[model samples]
Target chain A: MSASSERWPLRKLIFDTLFFAYGVALFADALGAMGVSAFHFTQDDFIQNFSHYATFSLLLTGVMAIVALVANLRGWTTPGDALFASPLRKLELSARPWSRSPWLWQVVIVFTLTIVVSVRVTESSIGDLLDADGLQGAWRLWSGLSQPNFNLLPRALALAAETIFIAFLSTVLAIPAAFFLAFFAAKNLMQGPLALAVYAVLRALLNLSRSIEPLIWALIFTVWVGVGPFAGMLALTVHSIASLIKYYSEIIESVSDGPIDGIRSTGANAIQTVWYAVVPQIVLPYIAMTVYRWDTNVRMATVIGLVGGGGIGTLLIQYQGQALWPEVGCIVLVIAVIVWLMDTASAYVREALK
Target chain B: MSASGSPLLNVRSLGKTYPNGTKALSDVSFSVDAGEFLVVIGLSGSGKTTLLRCLNRLVDPSYGEIDFAGRRIETLQGAEVRSVRQDMAMIFQQFNLVPRLSALTNVLTGQLAHQPTWKSLLGLHSSTEREAALEFLKLVGIADKARVRCDQLSGGQQQRVAIARALYQKPKLLLADEPVASLDPATSHSVMDYLRKANRELGITVICNLHYLSLVREYATRVIALKEGRLVFEGRPEEIDRAWFQRIYGEEARDVGIQ
Candidate 1:
């Protein structure tokens, strides 16, 4: 017998215990529905309305049990033997039968359950989504967008400029800090256990900082700096610097060993070796990474402003809350245009550098 | 050989055993007089590299005494070792030029041990150093390509640039680790010819690791053969014959001539 067969009995025992516990809980709930329980644990309303789907659930459960048993029997049967014994052998697909991929039916069941649960939890109705009331609301938003408020154009431009500036300043602040930290974080530079320890600590710090979103960081900073562009910049700087360290250190680690060897053979000091050999290799990629971070920061800066960290996002949130769809449309348009321009420009620069 | 006052390098009982327990070299005792083209030959992993690196203390010998220019080398550390290294230069099989850098900048980097850190970092080399770099590039016959990025050059040209870089250091001794291993036969000859010029004209003591027996015979003034990290033979290149080849390599290894 296979090694897994030894564990099968134990697994079967665990499954049986779980099934018995579930049955006991269901029976207890049924008694509670009849007001027979001392704890007064009420049954869910779902069971009272079970008449609607009882027949369907019973048939589904029975079929699922049979399918599960067949799938479990797969471990004991070889594909060739199962195929030879199968009545479906003439169909040609039975050469391997169900033995080769016993998990397929389980996957289908899980997927279907997920969809059913999601539909119930979300209370989503496809008919409601396509109804006239929803279509009318969508049309109103579209109509407002088509006739964006030109009067707020100048204000939108100013806020957009401020948002871009915050991103630029934060990215600029992040660059040098990330560049310095990367030396400590890069595995190639971690020569000894102590250096590796330093790398691990620095890596953990970066990961910790990166795990908190820029918006959340902005909320924290807004409390500290009292709500301004500086607070937003601080948030972006902290988040971007950590992320940039991860990118920059990876690039440093991947630099070809040839140049490092050549440089080291010159009797250059550690600093000189890194300056001459490693920096030259990673400079282009570092710049590209920084510019890419700046693009993301610009988008994030706009978002962070919703929490009172001074930018166009503050105005977008205000206009949205006030139901001034026309003003919101103008601000969004301006942001879209600027983001598109930055993306195109950075792409060109990266392409040229490459 | 010239009857020099003293051998330029004196090495005795040099050996290296890696942390993982691979013995790279053992009981390796050798010396080199100035202006000798010494070629080390062996099958791969036979410790020719470990031997060459030991001279400059690049790969520190676990047990050895190395006297270079009358100073104990293996005992030196940090700045002292660096100061000794400033007098020696190395070229590699891969050429090792910064691929994104202009050829001239790559050549100028050889002066890194001598120049102040900011000078090279800022690309502000003195006119004399810049002139010397260009002259070295001219010596390797790649003066016109000084402004070109190293990655854009052919393998031969890149190796030539590497030679120029090493030469620009004005090092008294040059260590070349399989410097022509990656090139075509003709290109190999071209690179080796520049190395020869450096020895003859610059009076730089040369030590190199080589694979091709023919190249060893053609270029080496003195030859040392390694078999399984042990020094098996040391003599003039002409002394290595069919039997010696079988011993240095293996009984079954035929001499594969590259033309």
Candidate 2:
């Protein structure tokens, strides 16, 4: 017997209870479906349907159970000496048989055949695949290359510029604000009830801003700022503050306590400690995170513009509504290029900072 | 102010109790004359570090006064404290040079108190200060690695850079807290040698906390020992024999407490 079995009969008891409960539930459901009035069945019609399905399910279940039992019994086990060796050595010793186990091959064959049969059952005709209502149209929608139009270039460029501008302006404004909030949030810097209160407020504000997606924020800002890049910028700014506060606080927490302790030991005041020590340690990571946030905001700006917040998404939406597939394709291409460029530039700047 | 004659640092009955209610130092009294090389030795948690930090008011004492150069540091506030810090320097066991900064820049940071915050932020050190920093780096024998980032240096080299930074401050007192505790045997001697040279040549009072009894005997002119946050021994290096150390360390101090 295994160590677990020798130690307690708890495992056997649990297994027996579960097995009995499962069988009882299964039998009760079957009888109830057969119009057993004592358990409340609506009609005897269920008896005919239940009998057919239950017989089929029973055959399938029995075959699966026997296969599982055979597979478990046939699996390989290492010798006692090998099993008791250091974990790494034991792993190496046991790996060969484990890999070559017959059940592994059986499982692979079963999975492959299941997929093949599924594909055959679900397969559609090539004519239907090529039809405008089917796979061909879906492919065109995905690639945006089946029909290409260059006429939307100017509008797309303008919207892309708007997206970049909004992201840049908002991120710039959010950085310093996040810095202050993060300082208050850091436990080493601020202590006591007042600090805790400030932390709670900042956390709530972060959650509130992030909870309402940027698109929703854009809609709200559109009402306030009258629907332009300005509204988009405002929305992105609020969202960036929420995101950056979390990132900046984590960065502040990871900063080396040495410099902070050194400053405090010098009898420097609290503000001085933050200015001299905390700021120095976090400066590089802060700049890197700010650049990353700007890149993410640019991507979000495009999505926000679908609701008239002013970006490439606006141009794409216009073409889409007009059924000008080629024009929409052109707009999407421009957006992709802009996003890729921003991502590459962000990576380059991050590397330089490191 | 001439660095002469008078004791550079004076501590009278200093006591510190942490917020968690652990008493770090109690009734500690010590004074170092100008240019004296004082080394404090004790087992771990014996408040040797607490005493040294109390001199610079780094870890503020809960009760008592520390007077450095006739000014009571424990009572100093704001700019007064900054002024005092400008006049004193500390070296850490970890050689806490800003790892991302060049060795020269680390040394320049020592002069930050003298400059406007704007200048320090912009890294606009005066040309004279820059030259002096290089000169001090040469004194510590790492001038060639001036432009190298601190992380690239070996432990001993990093400690040397730390010493150079403290030297650039032109401090009246250099408080080193177990400066060589993290270093290997060979490197520890070199670091101690530089500290001794600074003490003898520049008349800088070098007060250090050391774990090694042999190193303390070789380096320090005056030795101070503590046990459980109280002053237990104060005498010349020759007077700190096996019996005196036994009294200071007791049964708990085995390999660490004896020479």
Candidate 3:
């Protein structure tokens, strides 16, 4: 028999212990780097700031660890094993098909360790979030939501319309370019060495552009287009084009080859093949996906305004900056209503297409 | 086989070796006359499909000498090749209709080769073309389902629609690659009957691949058998006997009748 299939629980236990010790040492090193003598028992000042909560947390963790160790040594499973078992099975949640599979325990241990490491690295505390000044400010913000300045309704409505128009115009501008890019990027359509090279280049370019958020694009365009809805439209168009190409190409890629071969065998030209076969299959999905993009762009339009790309968001930022709570409340109400309307409309269109 | 005048299609020393080193067809020479319902019989991977596709230049032959209507079709390029395909309509086992489109529209797409670029793009069909499409649909016995989506139709009905589409091409030669493979025994006869009707009534030459020897016996005016990419037998359908089947299929192969 091979050594790999051998039952060596003792060796595994030793490796697991070594890994646990390494984690503890790493955590201490991090704390020490942050000027906390976390592992030094001789430090006189360390215990003063440790607090009662810290001591209780440490005691609880130590007890849990001991229980896990004892359970593992006795060849019995722990609660951690049950917690990481297949989530799909209701009655057989704790049942393991292969008792020797180590993925469950490894995942549970890694996940818990990640949470602790993240919290320590961020140096965040619950007390700072519950501070009196922060709580008071939050309360004040909530209170302003009760009374909106209805007198600014007309201006708010106009700005809301402008935001929607920005989204619509940008989506329209992006679609045709994305449509052309999709065919070139689709692996089924683009063959040969040169065409494949073009496909790769286009995919890389689209991925790079899409990886940046619309807000970042808006900021860059605001600098170029001089702070207006034009900047917002341009920014949204660029981001929408990159993202829609990916979606459109995926649809094109997965399209059934039956119709394509049917059209091709008819001696239909390349353009005719796409128009007759490819276009029919993709039309409904393209419309539904583009409508979805338009809905997302409506939401993005408001956010872009904070960067001076113009819309209801610009008014929102202005009123909120001056602490004119009533005007800010009015803009927020108008934006919410319009966004809700767009969402409902797009959802209806998508459902109808399906 | 008398040494008569020139045949409509003459193929000599045809061969196809795929890039993956699979020899799909080798030294396959055959002649097809006009208005003949020729059936190709073979097991899977015996180059029947490849031979049919190569007839319309769907799969380019690595080396071949093909003369269609006294023209050296093997050396034709671009528009000339496309024009040759326009005259040779091909149908598939899967009934490759654009599933989303109405059966009538899928049939209308067969006229794409004859239409102008602008008209085809605009999906503009003349009243006469529309009438002709419906007539073909009626001929296939699916005129009532012409307005229905092709995907919603049964396998037999979809194959009829495919036949209707091929009729719209007004092709001189029809190549069918296992057109009834997906249908039941009765439905298979029904679809094959339509092809036989087209060949007899419209004077269209058909070369089709058939899996069932019984179907070949019933429908084929002339029959050819292939084994391991080589043409093993060629004669009238009634000439293929148990010894011939053994030679074509292999020693261990048993003849399975469909009916």
Specify the highest-DockQ model's number. Answer: 3
Candidate 1's clash total is 0
Give the per-residue Cα lDDT of candidate 1 at A282. 97
lDDT of 2 at B102: 85
Model 3 chain B poorest ten-residue lDDT run: B1-10
How well is each residue in B13-70 modelled by candidate 1, as lDDT tens digits? 8899999999999888888889999999999999988888887777878997988877
lDDT order of candidates, top first: 3, 1, 2
- State how far residue B128 of model 2 sits from its true place (Å): 2.3
Report chain A TM-scores, every model.
Answer: 0.74, 0.64, 0.74
Off by over 4 Å in 2: A1-154, A176-185, A191-208, A262-276, A322-337, A348-352, B1-7, B250-259
TM-score of 1: 0.80
Give the alpha carbon lDDT tens digit for every residue of A1-354 in model 1: 455644344444334333333343344444554578742232354566566446645654565444434444654332222333234432544454564543334334445555554465576888988999999999999889778898999999999899999999999998899999999999997887999999999999888889999889999999998998999999999998999999999999999989888877787888888888899899999888888889888889889989988888888989989988888889889989988998998888888878
* Model 2 global lDDT (CA atoms, 0 to 1): 0.77
DockQ of each: 0.52, 0.23, 0.58
